[model samples]
Target: MSTRLGWTAALMLSALSLVPARAQDAPKTWDVPMGGNSYLTATSADAAKRGGRNDRWNSPDNVTSVYFRVDRAAELNIALRAKVPQGESRIRATLAGKAVEKDLKGAETADVPLGKVVMKAPGYVKVDLQGLKKTGEVFADIEALEVTPTGKDAAAVVLNYVKDNKDNNFYWGRRGPSIHLGYELPKGEPTEWFYNEVTVPVGSDPVGSYFMSNGFGEGYFGMQVNGENERRVLFSVWSPFKTDRPGEIPEDQKITLLKKGEGVHGGEFGGEGSGGQSYWLYPWKAGNTYRFLNRVHPDGKGSTVYTAWFFVPEKNNWQLIASFKRPKTDKHLTGAHSFLENFADRQGYLSRGALYGNQWSCDVKGEWHESTVARFTTDPIGRSLFRMDYAGGAKGQQFFMRNGGFFAENVKPDQKFTRESTPAKKPVIDFKKLEGADLGS
Candidate 1:
């Protein structure tokens, strides 16, 4: 009897082992944009299941659909988390051209599974939702579409989907930039300085404006070249208090203009309580390679100082742009990024491009490190509203972002960067000699 029981227990254990284990990781959720041009929508509300808000469409005539792109072929478990109001109603859903129908009765909210479909390649997943029958005035409230991956390649499928589809608002109806290098500091770990080199090929036509900014809203420094004509290096610090114009900006909120290049103007800019000072209109030439350096350090008392410096190969040295002090704060730098954009009225019908590389950062402890991998994103206003064509890619050893106007096909972000073993050498600049010298030419 004991031998027979052991045999039966062994058989049961083997059968249990044959059953597959459920995926332990939480599924990634993507928020569907309902108001944009690509997403055909009737109305939006504060009811959201995933993000913060959702949309609603009334009646059968008002139908809505969303088109999403993916990079791999895999099976997707798509479902709609929605609330059905009124009597029994028919809800039709389509995934990648395949259609399914479901009937909802009563007035409760539920997740309606919309059948699985195989995405054969890197392409769009078109989901359409409409009500076939509505007994009451209200039809449905769509919280969001819950898309879960199923099968052996589920992990790869989710990764490919995220990589192919980013919330890039600047490049509408187009693939993302081929390559980008971003060094995002670990959350809550801020740095004190950033340094990088940018090269604009001779006679490079910039569409509108390009910016390289380090730090964020509280304090920031960087440079901007507008329309390949206007060039300026900018630095600003937020005031402890909030207000707009220069006159109302407190003295502690202001960065004294110590020195500036010829034709540079220093004053306040921006709107509302979130304003900062601007020192711009400096002369910058095309086809010239330049170095940008920024520093954010705290003052002894209760303020922080933000400074910017620029180096032109012609000058062979670093020159200070400006420095501002922010009152009562001990914070390091945050949100470092570089972008190429066309602020022209014609939008992305034209093209402009530039090359940026050799990005490095220094922590508050004075340790230096080089940044390698970067995630690519775009301007939301330009992509959805203007419908422009923005392209980013790597070529050789350089990475570039281009939009508006014409760009050469070979321009890409393939530049190779060599890590420096030693700390960066400071440039030789005599502040004493520059203090009185006529810089504002």
Candidate 2:
């Protein structure tokens, strides 16, 4: 294998780098050490009655405490999760001296905004003693608590380290209500890699404009367009091609818009947000255009994570896009059409689709992963097309890319014309001699 091929295999297994937790900002967390066989199995009950049965509910610790010493007033976002029985359990967040209740169901993933309990002052925020009860004994697992800064100046930081080059500073900016971010592929790129995770501060609303793209064959891409604005977010892989074969494209293919999830392609629009992963492909286009959009934000810091892999074609190169938006007290994205209600299949593109449960449409694979225009390459180029791998088992996790490269190709079709089979005689000479002279007389 070539050096580029060797590096592509290396980036597949490792985790990515993560922003270090600040010494001062790390919140004090204590795990509840409750241990024993489950006292109760599954049962159905309401919120207050479920707290009545001892067998149905239990806490890691009888009590868990978290203290803070903020020098000044600061806005912070906090996240908490627990494994409780089917019925509702009474949970509380006591800040300074007041308490607020929260409800946890197994189906709802732990998102910063989901079961959020906010505090405005500095002091200890404690989860009070439980009033949980149920028929049988079950484990109420207490997850971790995370607190981070939130403000106009508070930005999500991303550092891309491709091959051996680091210092690729990727900056995302919030302009009024829109976001802008991009990066340059390193000279020595890698294939078969994953995007570990991107962290964002809490208190941010679900993002509306989600878009991302890289110049290569499509990889597995995902888009989570939840929340009330009902805006569409797009995340896709892209390339330029001329034939039906996969490796037909060369290393110089330009990045363009690949797969896209317009309007509310999956779930409903509400104040709530969700996250998940899926696959993607870039439709073949004649012109080479680098740069695409992932129109939505990763569902906050802990909600979105992905893993993808690309075959190292003959070339290797790529970049990433991530974003977020805060909740709006007013009307959302103005002048934008409702993409969900009036979606039409784009002409001249190969399309497939799927719908799961009630709200999600899994069209990225079963249907929408291919392009109508057939293009491929057959070159021994050193680099490979992009690859992506994703797993969301653990929230707030990171990834490390070992080795990779971007694949690009140039393939455009040439126009061809056919001549008529039979030749025409000189009929024009007879027409000129026949009628025009008589009309003048």
Candidate 3:
């Protein structure tokens, strides 16, 4: 072939190579909101709240972290959506063992590039933003983290997080995921009483955590970390009227207070549901096993009565929490389960866990049966694919559950577990003594 023909053939080969590069799909840029996707990881974490609720991270005291998930390993180009009210501010973004510093000074918020990060594997990734220096009142009102993936593997990346504000998801997403264990009661017998024990490990008990030990069809009996200085054993029974507002519940279908022990506070509660709530402020310590006993039975007057008593191991005595009679209900305990939940949205960044073991249920004939099998499950938050930090299963002879803290390990729902039964440890109770309480008129 001539020199002209050879040059034309070389050009055709080079053009073919360029076509593939130009046709490659552009990687998408994900704008992850900070309202429901960030945590204040500082010396005094709540110090970041000067601006607003969990939505704004404006503190210069410590690192403000944002978390999200990816399906595959990615080389992420990350930026911060922030603005300085006045003057310039210096900030640092750290991710995957790399840190990038940038200075910003803008009247309005804008996407400020912090540089690139490479996630080695698929899972949750944490990006820590710290204020190096600032000339304004605060470092910057960091609204969201803008992630733009590039490179050959970038097109395979999919980020998962609380994407929007619809349906109050920012509130629920920040609260993390709630997990539960469904107990398998004996099929042939009636559950007149449910007995279970809960032990929260030291350092695993955080504020706003509820370790529900016993749950029935109408109510639940559990203990919670209400505040830094307060802990309570709580029992509540729902009104059959089915309303979110307690004032709207018809008097006939309302839950009536039957009796309460000394120092126990009993009243009506609403928001989650209308119910009669009872609680006793007790100095419950962690790493100690606490026992819960719940009694449910029909009063023959077409109403069901629920009574709860919690054993204080420190005092070695079972104190009555309260008792309530539910109108228009004449059934025994049916749905037997225990759940772990975080009620405070701000506390969702911390990890908490509890152990449920030695479960037993008594029938009308006064025979106790052991519960060795259970199924692990999660709430809608877990299934929504937004928050997946939850786990539960049998570890030796007890079932343990862990949630929050943005952990990567997640236990799938409907997973069954069987713990070794401790039949020799059956509870011995004096039925006559418990029944002799003077439930006054």
Candidate 4:
């Protein structure tokens, strides 16, 4: 059996005691605007499924081209949203008289690439798109289109393995990192592998966001971003049993917090460009397998693991429990950094050590299971956290939950338990009740 979940990691130091508790209210409801324009439109015809006909095509030709006349001379960003298809295509851009092209390579079909078509002086520009040939078939589905002003540097960031699809209850929330990017699992089709992608404007300080896949059974997933140091940063998580969305976490399944840490801007946390943030924390309930993900900032430089704490009932003190199993696997990867997750009473913490390889795994059932995987950025700012409440630890283990935290160096630890021993209050968050909160930009 497999389980999947999505979450975020943030780091904050201080809080207003006796202060107005605003963040805990509820998410406000917001209306998402319809993106209808000549520049972008949804292509619903010529639809195909995985291993179905027309599945190899990146996107219906109808939505692939942006129809715009060049006024003077400017660089435009061509954003393509495609679920994992079957093959790769070389992405190209061209004007009435000029053209630029790049190879967009991948294994499955959901790789999203922000291809750029530069229009120089007085002529019309048309960006062309195609995939490169590889050992396996691969394709990308085109969704939204965006054009941005690129100063001299006109390279578009190509994103791969996207999870945005139709039928999802999506809405526009905040800008930058506070922005919430999510999707509701489709009811009819069984999702093979879900992917998600977000581009934080060129330069922005990202706080952190949440990834919640509240569904029964385990849903395998991951997150990645391309920017300064694309291959250095890494984040991942998993769910052992099953449950509903974050708003529906069961009372009996609420697990304790484990450990928490912050990866600051200078050392391994921050890389090349301007310093960034890194965080690690894990939240879990007993006997559940959750999907794990890893994401990178569109503009930050660095990555690190964050703080962790287990969710204890009534009593607020973070203590260690021996009822859950640690993550284990025989699968491994090359050139990537990895972590092992567990709980110390109520505190969630990832061991200080991580492995680098082309393949990696969390030991489980005294045997190794091959894992579905993805890659991450190098200059990662923030940390990765893992959580689980199962039946064993280390050596022979079973994974109950694994989560990743990014740009979370801003969230402070939970306020210290009140001196007066009050029963541990359950954290209250209800999406149905928060429907009145404003979510529109």
Displacement of the residue 219 alpha carbon in candidate 3, Å? 1.0
Winner by TM-score between candidate 4 and candidate 3: 3
Residue-by-residue lDDT tens digits, candidate 2, 1-441? 111101112222211111233466444322211110001112235422443123223532333333222323445555543444454455555544456666555633242232333434332233333334432243334433444445542233111112221121000000011111111112221221112112212222232212222212222233322323342223322232333333444434322222212221221121111221223333211122222212121223222222122211133322222222222111111111001110111100111111100011112121111111111111111111101110011111111011011101112112111212111211111112321112111
lDDT of 1 by residue, 195-282 (tens): 7666666545543454453545465555565533566666665666666655776666654544454545656665534444555665
> Candidate 3 on 1-441: residue-level lDDT in tens?
111100112211222222223344567777777766876666334643352233233445666678898767778888776667777888888886688889989867667887887877777888987878877766776667778888987776888887765677777888888899999999877888899999999998888899999999898999999988899999999999878899999879989998887899999999888989999999888898999998888888889889999887766777889989998999888888999999987678789999999999999888999999999999877888788788899988899999998877778888999999998889998755663133421
Query: Would you give me the overall lDDT of model 3?
Result: 0.80
What is the full ranking by TM-score, best candidate first? 3, 1, 2, 4
Worst 10 residues of 1 by lDDT: 1-10
Which residue segments of model 3 deviate by more than 4 Å? Answer: 1-24, 43-59, 435-441
Q: Point out where model 4 deviates above 4 Å.
A: 1-245, 261-357, 360-441
What CA RMSD would candidate 1 show? Answer: 15.4
Q: Deviation in angstroms for 275 in model 2? A: 56
Per-residue C-alpha lDDT of model 4 across residues 1-441, encoded as one tens digit per residue? 100000001001111221244453332211111111112122344442221123234333322322333334665554443333434455544433355554555432222445556555533333344433333344333433334445544332221111121222111101111111112232332232221211212222111222222111211122122212231122222222233332243333322222222321111111111111222223332122222222111111121111112223344332221111112211211122222221111111111111111121212122222222322211111111111111111111111112222111222111111111112221222222321111110
What is the lDDT, from 0 to 100, of the residue 105 in candidate 2?
A: 52
